[model samples]
Target: MSESTPSFVSLLWGTLFLRPYVFIFLAAYLCLATRHLGLGPTLLYLLLGYGIAWTSEFCSIHTGIPYGLYMYIPATHSQELWVLGVPLMDSLSYVFLSYASYSLALFLLAPLPRSPVSGHPVNTGRYNLATLLLAVVLFVTLDIIIDPLALRGYRWFLGQIYGYPEAGIYFGIPLSNFVGWFVVGLVMVAVLQRLSHWSVPFPWLSWGQSRSTNDGYLGAGLYLGILLFNLILTFYIGETLLGLVGLFIYLPFTTLAILVRCHPGFKAN
Candidate 1:
């Protein structure tokens, strides 16, 4: 098929499969989630993430409450899947992104030493309020990189899918957009955590027996993967300043995850 006259099958394939970045992340999400949470939980997480993401986009566009006033640009109108004016791939992206964030939290907030009396890991305080703050911070940190580059979607693998009703200072994205991502990210993590909590005998449910090199840490590593992916795109598109800005947030977290993974003392403590 010619570039200008691509077939409908081509568009469907492009949205779900041929888009290299999105497809790769989707595969990574499945693999990591199944490795960590088993098949049942992984499936559940996928559904929940998609539902929440689509709902939030629908609500935000209609009421301008969560994500501020914005509308999809539909630059690829007939070339991608859309439901209620939101791209299917866009909502689907949240499944992997937020799962990785929540996994990073699980790695960082893993409880202290295992109990001698019982093989079970000790329950720390209520999700450790400290962890909650850090998780949300990390989740929001992702959007700092995401929203700006997405506004420059014309330059990257991402087509121009959406835009703000009013652009703000951060590379033509509104501040409210980032706030919405943070809120939505927090909600995603919290729901997944609750689900993990309910799933009996899951590895993370142990709370204290954290593996530095296991699935939790793998999720953390994926954050760096995402950072690198965007940085490459930023460089390719000549968004040097934006690339540097992403570096500022991602590098420190990368260092921290490395330390947490390599240092024996950091395991289960």
Candidate 2:
């Protein structure tokens, strides 16, 4: 074996041990963003996430998958604060995720429900406060659906604190994790929306060159693609049918929720 092979294996082993949840988060991000962002951006995000995940291997913070399957071993403090356990790549994942979700919302779910909560009919425009709030809410809801399953095993990095196996159960999820997912997620989205100049009109995919592309096809494709790919990847990597079942159960309800939320006056008797 080459000199680097052992270290690489060790790093992978440590990541699995220390930050197991990274895999689930990474996988989920890949699946969602791939379907939504497609080609160039999708590949870019994947490489970015991989690099971040790789760097996190040296940090003081630990993350793992499957509760205990993998772990992140921290390098000595002399390596510099960011390099120790925080891996540059892992930090980068947040940027990618925040941008991906924000763009996806604008493209697929934004101009949201003419007032998602109070149901006040309003005009659709660019980046209004209300629009931003709705975007955050949508991202949080997606995180909520994901955390219960994600935190059960893979969740949180070492020293960071949130959703550990020992303490078990924080607001119906491992305690540390629920807070992390919600708080971090909210903050990330806020930063990306407020500070960044990276906005683009969607139907990021080329075929989406018309009104139907934005209005229906791209969104439909995202949902379907997520549903299919998640099922397959979850089964293959995790080797369990439960992931497939969860995806099947979620797609319909999620679709219904999206439809109801989008169509303001469509209340059923």
Candidate 3:
């Protein structure tokens, strides 16, 4: 490894040590994804997610296509690994975030059973247009909570890593940023939906048999975990107004989810 670039071992250790919370969420994703989607598909999602997210960031910084115009500060370049000016962890985050959102969408929209003996609540294992659209919305909603707080990363442990050229209407983040998230989320979830169909040959690579019926809950929980994590940080950093805005935005969705989850009619037979 060069002086500026750290070895994989060092990068992994540094990420684990510095961003343990990220790893916590990531570990949950790994277990839940491996169990429900099988190891092969889970690994493919990570690889594809990282590629798309990194490219989006790179493009946004240069041509301002998908995520609006923003630039990384490169303040952590020496301390952490950066791929072409974007932090490796920054792009890597989208993998879990997208998966969490996609899984939650499945939990909400799929024919979920309150209880099942042999399969997940989202037992259909099929993707439709509604699920795809809902997954995209859910994925973008995550950024609604995440990006605002992240913009103020200097106030917390995240540090000042990136910023927009101009101040945005909602918490200093531009509207185009969200539009960009929507586009990326749509593409990523759509890719995942396509991948869900392929059959893996290696039995050892598939975890479908050992998965719990409650695995869908775990997947949705990951989404909530990430949302709660950022909201808590927003409050912890004294951004009470911003945090409240996030709660207000999500309150209706949360209530809707609860109502849908509890309604006897919504539960599958």
Candidate 4:
């Protein structure tokens, strides 16, 4: 078959696969995740909670490194191309972590309540700006860890845009590989923030909520899983444990730092 051949069935499947249904599913999940925590705004967190993760997945596809593993998995007469070892699900973590960070930041800052763009009638002056910003930051941070790992052979690069056929390293990271991640991450975040303006019901969800145990735990779990999964892959499949350990250390510290900054008056010391 020619590459130009377009199958109606395939198109249909793809459309269904990329439909808005998952966003709805994500919103539902957010409610559950934040129900116990007393966080600021559950609904606002939903958009970044899902959109950022989606953005990360999209980033990995184009860059072919960072947040994904190059495993030769068994496919239908082919190998499964995954970004990290965890498949597409890893992208979803971008959303959860971004949301977690946004919520944590808000909780600590005690910012005014904003409303979702959808005009969901937020009680305070809520805005989705924080969520959007944090989403971008988290994605970039993931890449920072990934670029060096790929150069060190902890993660495999599917395509050689630069470097010495995967044997060379610049500052412990392949120049081409790092460039790819930075460019992709920057562009993706810009696009997603615009998309959120249109699709999100309330902008405040991005910046309107408080920190809660729920957000913290969910963020911790999502990141912890990513860290462990990468470590396991490092031992059995590759050598990306450095990135995993970095994440294990960085994520908790970030959450703690935000907490400390927000509630400076309270001191156990």
Q: Could you give the C-alpha RMSD of every candidate to the true structure, in order shown? A: 4.9, 9.9, 3.1, 9.8
lDDT of 3 by residue, 1-269 (tens): 65555787886677677777877877888888887778888888889998999999999999998988989998766667778888888888998998888888877765645345544454564478888888889898889989998899999999888998889998899999999999999899888887666687887667553445456546788998899889899999999998888899888778868877788575544
Residues 1-269 of candidate 2 have per-residue lDDT tens digits of 65433455565566555554455555555554444444345555455544533443333134432122223333412222233444433454454445445554554333434556656433343245544554455444444444344333233223322233454443344444434544555555555444322334454532212222233123334333434443554455463645655666566546755775676444331
Q: Which stretches of candidate 1 lie over 4 Å from their true place?
A: 1-11, 111-127, 200-213, 258-269
Candidate 2: stretches off by over 4 Å: 1-82, 107-126, 137-167, 170-173, 195-231, 237-253, 256-269
Residue 173 local lDDT, model 4: 50
Candidates sorted by lDDT, best first: 3, 1, 2, 4
Winner on lDDT (3 vs 4): 3
- Candidate 1 residue-pair clash tally: 0
Worst 10 residues of 1 by lDDT: 204-213
lDDT (Cα atoms) of all candidates against the true structure = 0.75, 0.44, 0.82, 0.42
| Model 4 per-residue lDDT at 57 | 44
Q: Pick the candidate with the highest TM-score.
A: 3
Please estimate how well model 2 matches the true structure, expressed as its whole-model Cα lDDT: 0.44
Candidate 4, residues 160-215: lDDT per residue as tens digits?
Answer: 21233233344445445445444444454444334323443454434533333223
Backbone N/Cα/C clashes per model: 0, 37, 0, 34
lDDT, residue 16, model 2: 56
Q: Candidate 4: minimum summed lDDT over ten consecutive residues — where?
A: 72-81
Model 3 residue 264 distance off true place after TM-score fit, in angstroms: 1.3
Q: Tell me the TM-score of model 2.
A: 0.44
